[model samples]
Target: MKTVLITGCSSGFGLETAGYFLKQGWKVIATMRTPREDLLPRSEHLRLLALDVTDAESIHHAVEAAGPIDALVNNAGIGLLSAIEGTSMDLARDIFNTNTFGTMALCKAFIPQFRQRKSGVIINVTSTVTLKPIPLLAVYTASKAAVNAFTESLALELAPFNIRVGLVLPGLAPSTDFGKNAASRMQNVFPEPYEAFAANFFANAKNTAVVTYAADVAHAVWQAVNDPSAPMRIPAGADAVALAAQSL
Candidate 1:
């Protein structure tokens, strides 16, 4: 059976994707900052590993433990919401560390294995915010945007080796803990000047009727892995598809 390694399996898209893969009868190595067995059903095909993508050592260990795999899903990420004026350099770096560098690092680690095997798929889960820019998310968008560019270029770089690279752009997934997690990182990030605008933005976000679901992302990843002819960029949700259409 083919094996797949997925990051950030603790919650949100990662967790849902892991479950989907399990249901498909694929051997899944689900990695998160902390390993939790309760999150998923008991299956011989499932193995959980502790992963902190931001740390090189942690990534190295996870890769070593995961063994060879047919696909790598870089779904692990952190969120940040704040006006540029209020976003500290350290906080920006932290956002990039997980969303940008972490994805790149894991790709770098797995490319050789995929190259040697002459078959593998790399799916990077990015946000649709890159397509539709908005206030208070400049840093987060930039971080995900970098992955989008990287995946596109890397797709060409690795095509000769039969290693497929694709991007999954998910829209606002209100059902996930994304907003709550972002809120934690946004402490004191709303300067007095941007507070009113920030409030308005969040209020509108809550009332937004269209949103992505974790399953939408899981399905997109499935396509990217199973369909050899799939496009490099696949928007996962209704809003994401609409935004992608508008961007075109």
Candidate 2:
């Protein structure tokens, strides 16, 4: 049985993806900041580990513990919603630390193994905001966009070794706790001049009918890891699919 290591399995897309992999009879090493065994079903194929993708030492330890794996899924990310004027440098760095650099760091840590093995797959979970710009999400969009570009270039860099790299761009998923997780950073983000615009944006977002779900992302990640012919970028929801089509 093939093994896969997935980050950010505490909840949301990572959690769903872990479950999907286990159902497919793959050994899964699910990592979170604080490992929780109760989140997933009891399965001999499942193992949980503690990981903080922002910290190099944590990555080292997790990689050591995970041993060899057939695929690596970089799905751990944080969200930020704020106007540029209100976004402080520290806050911007914090977003990049987890969403951008964290993904890169994990890839760097695992590339050597994948390269030596002459086989492995890497799937990064990004956001569709990178495809179509969204107001109040400049920092978040840029972070995910960087991963998209990085994945494309890295795919070419590793292709000679038969190592595959791909991206999964998910649309807005209101059912997840992304907005709530970002609430602290989003506080007072709307300056006086942009208050009306921010209010309207939230109102419209609440009423939007099309949105991504955790399962859609899980399915996309599965395909990216299992299908050698899968495209470099696979949008993972109805809304994301539409945005990707329009962009093309």
Candidate 3:
């Protein structure tokens, strides 16, 4: 059976993707900052490991423990909803650390192994905001946008070794913990002048009917990992799909 190592299996798309892979008869190594055995179904093909993507030591340890894997899913990420001026350098750096650097670090850890094997897949979970600009998510967009570029470039470089790179651009998921986490950390987000705009934007976003779900993203990741000829960027939701079409 093929093995896949996924990051950020604590919840949302990561958790759902892990379950999907397990159901498909693949050995799954689900890594999260805090592993909860109860979160996933009990299966002999499943293993849970603790991983803080932002911490180098944690990533190194987790990858070492995961043994050989056929695919790497870079799904661990944090959301930020703050204006540029209001967002401190530290806050911006933190967002990049997890969403950008963390994914790259994990890729670096596995690249040698993948090259040696001459076969592997890297699926990165980015955001649709990179395709369509959003107001309050400038920082978040920038971070994911970097990953989009990185994936595209890496795909070209890794093609010689037959390693595939894919990107999943998921739309806004109001029902997921991502919205709650972003809201909870927005205390220092908007300046006084932009408060009204931020409020209206969020309220509209929540009430919108075009939100994506964990399953949709998980399926997209599965498709990306399995389809060797898949596009570098795959839209994982209705909203993202519509936007991507318009872009073309």
Candidate 4:
């Protein structure tokens, strides 16, 4: 059975992907920070671990635990919705620490194994915000844009070793708890005109079709991993697909 290691599996896209992979008869190593006691899904092929992608020690330990994996899904990420000027530097740094630095660190830590085996796939879950320069989420979009660039560079570097590097653009998957999590992370207390603008931005962006389901992202990841010729970027979600087309 192929072994797949996925990060941030306590909830959202990571949780859904972990469950789906397990159901497909794949051995899954699901990692998260502060894993819930009741969030456990029934699966014999699942191995749950505590992970904070921001920490090198945690990532090192997890990779050591998951030996000779067939694939690595960097599904772990944090979202921020504040304006670039209004957001605190500390907060922006923290988000980049998790989304940008952490994702790249995991790839570096695991690439040796994949290269040695002459196999394995790496799927980095980015956002469709890269395609469209949204107003309020400059920092968040920048981080994902970094991931997209990394995916392209790493794909070429790893091709010789037979490992594939790909990314998924989840346009507006409101089904996940990203909003709540973002709200919790945002203690910045917006002031003045920005607060009103944030409200308006949320109002305009809210729509069912614009939001992609967590399952849809997982399905895209599945195709990216199993397919013989998966594209470097798998555009998931209805809104993401549309955003991708707009670039063309």
After the best TM-score superposition of candidate 1, give how far the Cα of residue 126 lies from its true spot, in angstroms. Answer: 0.2
**lDDT (Cα, tens digit) per residue for candidate 4, span 1-248:** 99899998888898888888888899988889876646657677878888889988988888787878999999999998887767888898988999999999999999999899899899999998899888888889999899999889999999999999999888787778988889986666365768888888788878445668898898998999899688788888887888899987
Candidate 1's residue-wise lDDT over 1-248, tens digit each?
A: 99999999999999999999999989999999989989999999999999999999999999899999999999999998898998899999999999999999999999999999899999999999999869889999999999999999999999999999999999999999887877878889988988899989989998999989999999999999999988889999999999999999
In terms of TM-score, which candidate is stronger, 2 or 3? Answer: 2
Residue 138 deviation, candidate 3, in Å? 0.8
The Cα error of candidate 2 at residue 49, in Å, is: 0.6
Clashing residue pairs found in predicted model 2: none
Off by over 4 Å in 1: none
lDDT of 2 by residue, 1-248 (tens): 99999999999999999999999999999999999888999998999999999999999999999999999999999999889998999999999999999999999999999999999999999999998878999999999999999999999999999999999999999998888988988877778999999989999999999999999999999999999999999999899999999999
Clashing pairs in 1: none
Where does candidate 4 stray beyond 4 Å?
A: none
What Cα-based lDDT does every candidate model obtain?
0.94, 0.95, 0.91, 0.87
Q: Scored by Cα lDDT, where does model 2 land?
A: 0.95
- What are the clash counts of all predictions, listed in order? 0, 0, 0, 0
> What pairs collide in candidate 4?
none
Error of 1 at 243 (Å): 1.0
